[model samples]
Target: MVHNCVFSFKLSSAREGIRSEKVRELIPDMLSSYTVNIAYHANNPDVGMALEKDAGRYKLFNSDVGLFITLAFKDKKYTENIIYNKLLSDKLDVNLGYVYENVVAQMLIAKGNNLFYYTMESKTSNHLYEIDFLTSVKDKICPLEVKSGNYRTHKSLDVFCNKFSNRICNKYVVHTKAYKWENGIYYIPVYMIPFL
Candidate 1:
């Protein structure tokens, strides 16, 4: 089996201060089922190529948009096992949930060509916010806001929703619990993504 996982982080924040809590939550499952692959944005093609050449042999996929990976698996059952383990683990964090949201978005992109994924960058005074994922399905752009805890109205999400209401079909806030579609947005838990 082959699994392609694309993890995205907001680049507006300082690289060092951006917490690894999200990556920490994802690493165990990714490492168990398939060899881990990672990709990031590169401003220079020559530098990106140099890094890839030094990064060793693996399945690498690149595009004008950004960097990404394609993971080849020796077994499929490990997928289920890793998921089950992640559910049982109690160390999960909110930052980790945001990372998982990107993983889920990439998984959806891998499943079909009709869908397009992008990240949103916005500014408010001196503060900047980058939404985890923006997906276009059936010509409608859906902005996804990731939360690790109980679902609630978020200020950033609200701001994005209000600002892009004309372009966005509905804003989605993904969490770790159940799914709900209230108002014009969808509140979906991580486990329901494969089905959605």
Candidate 2:
């Protein structure tokens, strides 16, 4: 339950050399066994099995974050993993957006919530604006953006809310901050997400 503290990861393919297609085939079984959880990227504000979602573009999170952390350090000896060393000194200088997203998935799932997200390519740039999580409430959508550390902006959430204000009921920026509500958005502390 280390909710905060900074960490980052660079994308890397699986070390076992399993083809991604084969991995995809095994995912249904994994999901059924609670080995993994999936957050779909939806095209609209629908929930449950009725969502118009992209099966091809989704985020996968391990069902257990502690196990995921342990598996991330698969060294023969504990002293050899560079990440473990950095983590010990509290000097990790990485962006761990995925980690926070994984924990949020766990909390949401534990509270019987299904996960969804939204992403759109920027009109002016080649980059994409991504809302980290999206939930439907009373037929309107709620967009959540997760930020770690002393960050002060929610660019993706802003863009999403601006475009879909009519379809949105609430906007949330979840981070390591005190709970507050301002400007039509709720600033929720990360620890309180389970009760949300």
Candidate 3:
């Protein structure tokens, strides 16, 4: 299920060498205490919204991040010594984007927010631009993108804001940096998510 959370259906299949249907079947208790699947916002005109579960875009995440950390180290026979030290010292050699995303999902869930994200292919290029999470702030939708680093090329956030300017209340790029407003987008630290 973590594979499904990190990679798309096709990419996960290629990486894990399993059929996509099998991935869907593994997490039977979806959106419950065991797991949660964040569905794409289908109402967007370019999204080609589909009612069918298998036809829609989604990202899976563990309901509790504490359990998730333990599950992540399952292959090591419960030996989380290396993982603990690395995380504490901030030197883990793995991609932390998924970890951040999972934590954000857990936080949002704790705050009683249903998870949803948006992704679209660029018209000029084949590159896909994605908003990590879309949350309703008051009456307007807030588009958020999570970044592990300080880089600032958030094409998806930009595109989504431009396309749905009136619908958006505040655009955010969640990262490790201090809170600041650049142009109209708010660069918020990960710890500040709960307040937002």
TM-score, one value per model: 0.49, 0.79, 0.79
Model 1: colliding residue pairs: 22-96
The models' CA-based lDDT, in order, is 0.47, 0.72, 0.71
* Positional deviation of residue 187's Cα in model 3 after best superposition, in angstroms: 1.3
How well is each residue in 1-196 modelled by candidate 3, as lDDT tens digits?
Answer: 2235656656454666665666556555564445665654444622222332233356777666767777776786685687879875778777778878888887887787767777778989999787888787666778889988654988888888888788888889988778899898899988888998
Candidate 2 runs further than 4 Å off: 1-21, 46-49, 73-76, 79-92
Order candidates by lDDT, high to low: 2, 3, 1
In angstroms, the error of model 1 at 149 is 2.0
Candidate numbers, best TM-score first, in rank order: 2, 3, 1
lDDT of 2 by residue, 1-196 (tens): 0111122222233235445455557768978999888877687754552457766556778888877766665565453567867754646676556666778888988988887777788999998788888877777778889986554688888888888888888888888669999988999977888877
Model 3 lDDT-worst window of ten: 45-54
Off by over 4 Å in 1: 1-95, 113-124
TM-score of 3: 0.79
**Clash number for candidate 3:** 0
